[model samples]
Target: MSRKRSRLSSEEEMSSKLSDGGCGEGQNGSETSITSATSQAPIDALQSLRQAAPYSTEPEAIAERERCHYGRIPRAAALAGTAHRKVRVYSDGIYDMFHQGHARQLQQAKTVFPNVYLIVGVCSDSLTHSRKGRTVMTEDERYEAVRHCRYVDEVVRDAPWEYDEEFLEKHKIDFVAHDDIPYTTEDCEDTYALIKAKDMFVATQRTEGVSTSDIVARIVRDYDIYVRRNLARGYSAKELNVGFLNEKKFRLQNKMDDLKEKGKKVMTNIGEKRVDILTKWEEKSRELIDAFLLLFGPDGRLSNIWNESKGRLMQALSQPPSPRGSPPPGENGDSHSPVHSRSSVSPPPPKSRRYETLYEAQAGNWMHRALNVLATRKRPHSGS
Candidate 1:
C-alpha cells in the first residue's frame, strides 16, 4: 500500500511539473517557458493555416483560392461596420517635382480605410514623355520621391501608364486611388474607365488651386523674373541655359534697375535736404554778390581807383617823354632839352581795344612812330 501511495504521489508530482509549463525547473524558468510558448502559438497557428488550405473546403481555403485566382481582397471584412484588414491601395502618377499636392493624394489613399498598405507607382520617364509630356524629374528621382513619402508603404518602379488586369493583379491592388477627374489619353477617353467599371476606383479629393501643372504654369509665366532672380543669386548663365546675348541683356536690365534704385535714393536725399541747401545758398550768394560789387561794379571801389589811375596815365602820356639822349632823372648832370624830367620807371602796358581810354584815334600813328624810334635806337658803346 505504501509503494502504491508513493507511485501515486510521483505521478501527481509529474503532472504538476507538466502543468508548470512542461519544465521541471523553478517558477522563473517555468514562467519563461510559458512566455516563449505563448509567443510561438500565434506563429504556429498562422503556419498551419497557410499549410492546411490546398485541398480543404474551409472558408480560409476558399478565400485563399479567390486571392490566388483574382488577386481580390475580402472587401466585406474591411467595410465600415466590420473588422478592417490591411487594404492594399494602389496609386500611380508621374509625380514630377513631388509637391504637396502629390503628398495629399497619397495621404488620402493611406487613410481612406482603417489600415491601408499604400503602393505608389511612379511611371517611367519614357512612358510619361510618351503619354503626357516631359517630366521635370527623372524616373529614378520620381521613384525615390514616392518611396520616401510617409504615406507610401511600397514603391513600384516603371509603373504602367494605364492600368490593366494583369498590372492590377501583379501588384495585388485592391483599389486604384486617384482624383475623380476624367484623365484623357491619346488611345482612350478615360484611362480609369475599366477600374471604375470594376468597382475598384477610389476617388481622392484634389487640393484646390494647386497642382504640378499649375506650378509649372506659374514658373513659365514668370520665367524671366525667376531667371533674373537666380542670376542675381550667383547662378551662372550657362547653368541656366541662357545664351550670351540674353545673359548680357539680363545683366544690363539688372544694372538699369540698380541705377533706378540709386537715383530714387539720391532724389529722396535731395528732397530731404532741399530746404537747408536753399537757405545756405541764399546766405552764400549774398556774400558773393557783395564781393563782386566791391571788385567790379560800376560804382565800386575798384572803379574809383581805376578812374584815378587812368587820369594820371593820360596826363603823363599827353606830355612828351624825356628825350632818350637826356641824362636820367636824379643824376647830377643837367638835361639837354627843356622838357621836364619824368619818373624813370617803365610805363604801364597799353590797354586792350575794348578798354581804350583816350588814344582811339592816334593809336595806329603812335604805334608806327614808336616802332621807328625803337628800330633807330643803338646800344651805348662799352669801353674795353
Candidate 2:
C-alpha cells in the first residue's frame, strides 16, 4: 500500500509540473506535440497566404483574418512557423548597379517568409561575361552592393550559374526565390529546373516598367546627352571614353541645347506680350529717328544753318569791292600811296606782293650806290 501511494504522488507531481509548463527530458516529446497542435491556426493562416493569388485585391480575406487573429501575422509559418527556426531563403542575380528592381526582389523574398535569413548570391565577372554577357559592375562591387542591402543577411561570391543539389545542401537553403519566368540557357531549357522540381522555388513578382536592361537601354538611347552632362559636371573626355572629335561634338550639342532652352524660357516669359514689346520697340525706334533727323538730317537745324551760311558766302562773292578813300585825290596808276583806283577796271594788286616789290627796289638802290662809290674811287688812278 505504501508503494502504490508513492507511485500516485509521483504521477500527480509530474502532471502538475507539465500543467505548469515545466520542461524536462522525459516531457520534451509531449511538449513538442502540444506546441505543434497549438501552432495549427497560424500555420493554416500562412498556407492561405501562400495559396492566395499574387495580385489578389480582395480585402474581405484580410478583414476576416484580422478579425480572427489578435497578434502579428506569423512569418515563415509554412516551413518553420513562428515558433521554429527562421527559414533560409536564397536568391541569385547579377545585381549590377543595384537599382529599385533588385531591391524590390530582395524585399519580396524577405517578407514572403515572416522570419527569413536572406542569402544573396552574386556571379563572377568572368562567368557573367561568358554566359550572360558583361555586367555593369564587377563581381566584388556587386557582392558588396548585395551585402549592404537591408533585406540581405549573407552574401555568397562567385555563386554558381545554375543551382544543383550540392549547392542547395551546402547553403542549407529552404527556398530558392526568384521571378516566375524561366531562365533559359544554351545547354538547357531552364536553369532552375532542379530547384523547381524539388518544390524549393518561391516566385517573386517582377516589378514592371523597370529593369537593369531597360536602364542600360535608356542610357544607350540618350548616349550623347549623358556624356555631355557628365562633361558639364567636370568629368574628362578620357574618363567618359570619348574621342576628341566626339567630345567637341557633344560640347557643341550641349551648347546648342542650352541655347534652345534659354530661348524657350525667354519666349515663355514673354508669353502673349510679344506684340506689346514690338510696339514699344517701334515707338522707341521712331523717337530715335526723329531725334537723328532734328540733329543731322537733310531738313535738320544744322542743315538749315549750313544752307543760310552758304547763301551769305555766295552773295559776298558776287558783290564788288568798295573803294578806299576815293583813290587819294587823282593818283590813278602812278600813285605812290598804296590805294585802289576807282577808275581802273582791273582789281589792285594784293598787299603782300606790293610790300615784296617795295623791299626789292630798296635793296637795288643801295647796291647801285655802292657801285657808284667804288667806280669814283678807282677812276683809273690817272695821276698815279
Candidate 3:
C-alpha cells in the first residue's frame, strides 16, 4: 500500500510539468488544465507583466494617435483655432551678445501671448557665411547656447532662405514675433504673407540698444586706446577744425548768442582790462569783414594792390623789432613820432599818391594793425 501511494504522488507531479507530452485524461482535458494553471498565477506577477508593456497613452504617442485619427488636418483648419489660442513664435540670429534688451524683447513677446513657443532658428555656420560673410560662434555652439535660454522652447537650423510656411503651418503656429529692427519688415513680410494667408497673427516688439553689431563695435572701441593715441599724435589742423568747431557750428552759434546776453548783464561789473579786451575783439571782427570785402571788392586793381601791400606789411611786422626803437621817417615834413607814450602816439603820415588810393591803403593798413593788436591781447571771455 505504501509503494502504491508513492507512485500516485510521482504521477501527479509529472502531470503538472511545464512541457509534458500529453495529459493522462485526453488532449481536450489537458488544454482546459493548462488554461486553469495560467489563470491561477499570482495577481502581482500579472500586474507586473502589464506594466512592463509600453504605455499606449503617452503624450508623444497620444499626439501621433490623434494625428492619425485627424488624418493631418488642413492648414486652414489648424489656423482656424488660432484666433482663440494666443500662440506667439519668436526667432533671431546669433544672439552672441545677449543683453537685457534681448531679454526684454523676449519678455514682451511672452506677455503678448497666452502660449509662448520660442522657435529659435540658428543659421548654420555655412548658411551664415553665405548671408552674413561670417559668424562669431559655430552652429553647434549657437544651437546649444540658444537651447539653454529661458525663453527658447525649441531650436532649429535656419536655412539660407526664409522660414518655410508649410513647416510653420504643420506645427500649427499662430503669431510670428521678432524684435523691431530696420529691414525686418521686408525680411519678415515674405514669411509673414504665408502666415497671414493661413489667417495666423503677426507681432513685433521694440528692442532697446542691444545688438550683435553694436556689441562688437563697443568691444572694438573700448580696447582701441592705442589706435586713438596714434590718431591724436598724427591729427591735422583741418581735421581738428572740422571735428571741433565746424561740427558744432549750430550749437556754437547758439552758445555765442547766450554768451553775448551774459556779457551784457555782467558788463558793469567787469574791469577796464576786460572792457579793453572786448573792444579789441569787436574791432578784430570788423577787420575780418574788411578783409573779406578787400578780397571780393568791386575794384579789381584796388583789391590786388591792397593784398600786395598787406603781404609786405605782414612780413615786416613778423620781423623782430629794431634795437634802436625808432619809427621809420615819413615822406611828409613832419618827423616820425615817439612809439612809447600813449599821449605822444601819431597816425601814419598822409601819402602824396592819388587821394582815393591813399585812403584805401590807409584803411587796409589800419584794419591789419587792429587784427594784430587783438591777437596779442588776452581774451576776456572765451568764445564758442
Candidate 4:
C-alpha cells in the first residue's frame, strides 16, 4: 500500500509540470502575435493615405497644387466651383505679353480667396476675334505663354460665348475675378450672377497699365511715320483734304518768313551802294521763300526768287573796277566801292533810312549767324 501511494504522487507531479509548461508556451505565442500587429499598423495607415491622396497630372490635382503655391484660387477655378473651399476666377483674354499688370491681377485674385485654387481661361484666337476685333498673338502662343507664369495655376481653352451658370456649376466655381475697371460689367453679368447664386465671392482688383489694346496703340503711335505713309496711299480725296499734309506746309512757310526777315536786315547794312545790298537781299529772300513754297504750296506760280537773287548778287560782286581812276578830290570813291579810308570820307548820318532798315534787319542776324558758325565749327580742343 505504501509503494502504490508514492507512485500516485509521482504521477501527479509530472502532470502538473506538463500543464505549467503548456501555459508558458501559449503566453509566448500571444506576445509574438501582438508584436507583429504593432509592426504592421504603420504600413496599413500608409496604404490608406495613398488611396485618399490626389493623383498628380489630373486637372483637379494640378489646380490644387497651383492654389497651394500661389496661396489663392485661380480666376477660372473660382468661376468653376469644384470644391466648397475652392474659389473660381474667370479671366479671359489673349494674354499676349504677360507683364506686371497680369501679375498684379493674379495676385489680387489670390488675395480674395486665400484658400482656393486658380484656373486660367485663355480665349482661343477665333473666340477672341468675336469679342476683341483682333489679337496680337495666336491661341496656342497665348496658352503656352500664360502657362509658364508662376502666378498662373492651370490653363483651359475658354468657350466662344459668354460665361453661363451651367458652366460655372459644372466646375464648382466660387468667384468671378476682374480688374477694377467699370467697363467689364456689360459682358460679365452672366458669370457674376452664377457667382452670386453659388454664394461665392466677386473680386475686382486694380491692374497696372498693361493692356493689349494700350500696347497696340503705342506701337501705332511710335511708328507714325510708316503709318502715315501707308495711310496717304489708301486715303480718299476728302480724307486728304483735312489739312494733315497742310500742317507740314504751314511749318515750312513759317521758316521762309524767318529767312525773309534775315535777308532784309543784311541788305539794310550795305548802305550807299544800297542797290547792291538790295539786290543781295532780294536774292536770298527769294531762295528762302521758294524753298518754303516748294515744301508747302502746289507746283504753281511761286517763282524761284532766291535763285534769281543769288545770281544777281554774284554778277554785281564780279563786275570790273570803274574805268576811271579813284574819284575827284574831296568826293568819296565810287558809290559801289568798298574802300575803308576813314579820313577821306565823312560818316553817314545816323538817321539815314538805309541805316534804319539795316539796323532793323540785322538786329538778330549777327547772333544767329554766330550760333550757326559755332555749331558747324570743328572742335580742335575735344576732350577725347
Candidate 5:
C-alpha cells in the first residue's frame, strides 16, 4: 500500500503523455500508469514513446559516471520537505519481457501525481501459463524485469488477479492506474471494477509493433536455423520433436518424378533448388557412410596402402649412391665389398611443387603415419 497523495497541476498534460485518453486515474481521481503483464509482448495501437529512463544505480558518484557516457538525465527530485500527500499508485501485469513500453507505462503512472510510490504486481508463472499457452520468460524472470522498471518502487510476486479492500487499505492505495478497458480473467469478474468504482482506473495507450508473439513468429520463420542449433547442442531430431526423414520419404518418393517431369506447372526455380539440395545432401551422406565403414573395417585393410607406399619409399631411400663399383666378396683373405646395383624401383623424381590450388592427389601425414603403424605391427612368422 502506498500513502495517499494529491494530483499534480500537470493533470491535463499527464493525460496526453500516456495514451490519447491520458494515464488512468483512481476512483478518487488519483493517477498512475500501467504495466503489461503477459508472457508475450502486447499487441496494441502503436504510439511513439519517449526515450526510456536509464537503469537505476547505487551510489550517486558511480551513477554520474555512467550517466555521462549515455547522456542520461540525473535522477533527482525535490519532494523531501513538500507538504503534498504521498501518493501510492498501483499497477501490475505479467511483464514477461520488459521494454520501453513497460517503462513508458510505469513512468506515466508514477509521474501523473506528485510524491508518488508505484507498486507493481507480477502474475505467477502458473497463473500466466494457465491463461496463456506458453510464456518465454519464467515467473521469476518476469518479476525481476518489472521490479527494476524505473517507474516501480515496489514489486509483488505472484500478484493477485483482482484487488482487495484489505490490500488497498494496508498499502494506502489512493489510485489504481490501468487502462479503462475491463480486465476480466477466470479469477475475477472485472479485475479493475473495484478500483474503477473507487475512481482509480487510469487509461494508458498500448504501444504498437513489438510484442512477444511477433518475436516468436520471427524465430519460427527461420525454422532451419532452430533445427541446426538444436543439433549443435547434441539434441537429436527425435528429441526435438522433429519427424524422421523416413517418415517424410513419401513426400519425395511420390512427388519427385512428377516434379521433375512437370515441375514448371507448380514448382518454381526456388522449389527446384530445394530438391537439388536435398539430393546432394543425401548423396554426400551416403559417400561419407561408405568411406567410414571401409576405413574402420575389422581387418583395417585401408591402412595397407599406407604401409606398401612407405615401404617402397624407405627401401629406395636406404640404398647409398656409389661412384665406383665394389667387387663381390672373394674367397680366402682377398675379399672385396659387393657393388650395390641400382634397383628397378627408384624414388620418383623429386616431387614438383604443384600449386595447392590445383589440389593434386597427395597422401597427408596422418595417412602415412597410419600405414607405418600397421606395417610395423605385422608379424611375418604368424602370417596366415
Candidate 6:
C-alpha cells in the first residue's frame, strides 16, 4: 500500500492501455497518427493526476491505479473525488456476543474517513474474563464474527483492554475510534482522556436499544431454562447455584391443592349460609377470576402463574403452625390454615410433610399436573 508501489501499478496499467491502442491503429499504416496518439498518454496521465483528489503522499499515482481497478471509474470523475488520506483507524473492544450494535460502531468507525482501513481489535479471552467475567462466545469466535463484518478491513488478535502509546505506534493507527463513554479501569487511565491528549481520538456514536449486556440480562430473566442450558453444556448444579426441580415442583403442587381446597370451601359456604346453589357457583367463579388476576399481574398470562403462586404461597406457609391440642381453629380463634378457616380465606398453610414425594405414582401425577398448569395460557373465550 506504499506510494512507490502504487506509482508502479499505475505506470504498468497506463502502458497496457497505450499498447492496446497502438495495436488497434497499427494496421492503418499511419506511424505519425500512432506517435501523436502515444503523446496523449502522458497528457491524460497528467490530467488524471492534477485534477484529482489527493489520496496519499503520491495522490496522482494512487488515484490512477484505483481508477483502473475492478469496476473502472471514468478517468475524469475518478480524479474529481474528495481527497482523503488512507486512514488506519483503530477500534477495540471485548466484542462479546457480537450483534447489531457492534456492527453499527464498526460502521461508524469506517465512515470517519473516505477510503478507510478499519482495524478491529478483540481482547484475549483471559483478559476479557478478568474484566467482564464471562462471555457467551470464546475469543476466537468473537474475533471471526468481527472479522467477517463488511466494514472491517483487518482484525488484530489478543488486543489490550486499553490503548497505549506502544500499541498505537506498533499498529501505525491514526485515530482511536470508539464511543464517547468514559472507560475507567484499574489497568489504565480513562481511555478517551488518554487518546484525547494526543488528539487522535475519533468518538463514534454508541448504538442504542441493543447491547451484549442486555442480551445477557434477557438470558438471566428466563432463569430455569438458562440454568438448564448451562447444565447441558457440562456445567453442574453447584456451578449454577440451582436445585433439582422435583422438590420444588412437589411443594408447588401441594400449595396449588391447598388453594383449590380453600376455593371449594368458599363455594360451599356460599351455598349453605349465603344463598341458593346457582348464586354460590356464580360468586365462586368471580372469586377464582379475581385470584387469577392477582396471580398473573396485568398481562393475565397463566404460563408462569404456578411458580409465581408457589413463591407467594411459600411466604404464607413459612409461619409456624399452632399446637394441635388446642381447639382445631376458627371456633374461637384464627384458623390454623386457609384450608380449614371458617371464612375460607386463602391464608397461610400449616407446616406439614405433605410436600414430600412419598408415593411414586402420586409424585408423577403432581409433576405432570404442575407442568400442565405452567404450560397453560389464558384463553380469550374463557370467563376467567
TM per candidate comes to 0.55, 0.55, 0.35, 0.36, 0.40, 0.42
CA lDDT, every model vs. true structure: 0.73, 0.73, 0.53, 0.56, 0.57, 0.66
Q: List the candidate 4 regions with Cα displacement exceeding 4 Å.
A: 1-90, 180-191, 224-384
Scored by TM-score, the top model is 2
Model 2: per-residue Cα lDDT over 10-127, one tens digit each: 6565555556665655468777567555554344434434452111123643343233323222333644455355577789899988999999999999887766657778888999
lDDT for each residue of candidate 4 in 1-384, tens digit (9 for 90 to 100): 998677556545544544454343456766655544443333333333344322234666556545542334445554454333545455544577666777677666655654434566777777668766777777767776766655554566654345665666544444656653333445564534544555454655655566776787787786544444534456542453436585465445556767998888876665657898788888899898887888656653344565677889997665343223433222221233446433344434335544664565465566667887998786566676
> What is every candidate's alpha-carbon RMSD to the true fold?
17.8, 17.6, 31.2, 33.6, 28.8, 33.4
Regions of model 3 farther than 4 Å from truth? 1-90, 180-191, 196-201, 224-384
lDDT of 5 by residue, 200-306 (tens): 66667666776667777887898666666665567766776778783255335435646676767556766758888888889899888887878876545667777
Per-residue lDDT tens digits for candidate 3, residues 42-110, read 332233334421122335423523443223233354345343232435455655545666666655655
Task: Give the per-residue lDDT digits (tens) of candidate 1, residues 307-356.
Answer: 99999998877644333443432222233433533444534334452245
Sliding window of 10 residues with minimal summed lDDT for model 6: 69-78
Better of 2 and 5 by TM-score: 2
Error of 2 at 293 (Å): 6.4
lDDT of 6 by residue, 198-302 (tens): 777778898787999999888879865665455556776677766777435544655676799999999888768765767768979988888888767665667
In terms of lDDT, the best-performing candidate is 2
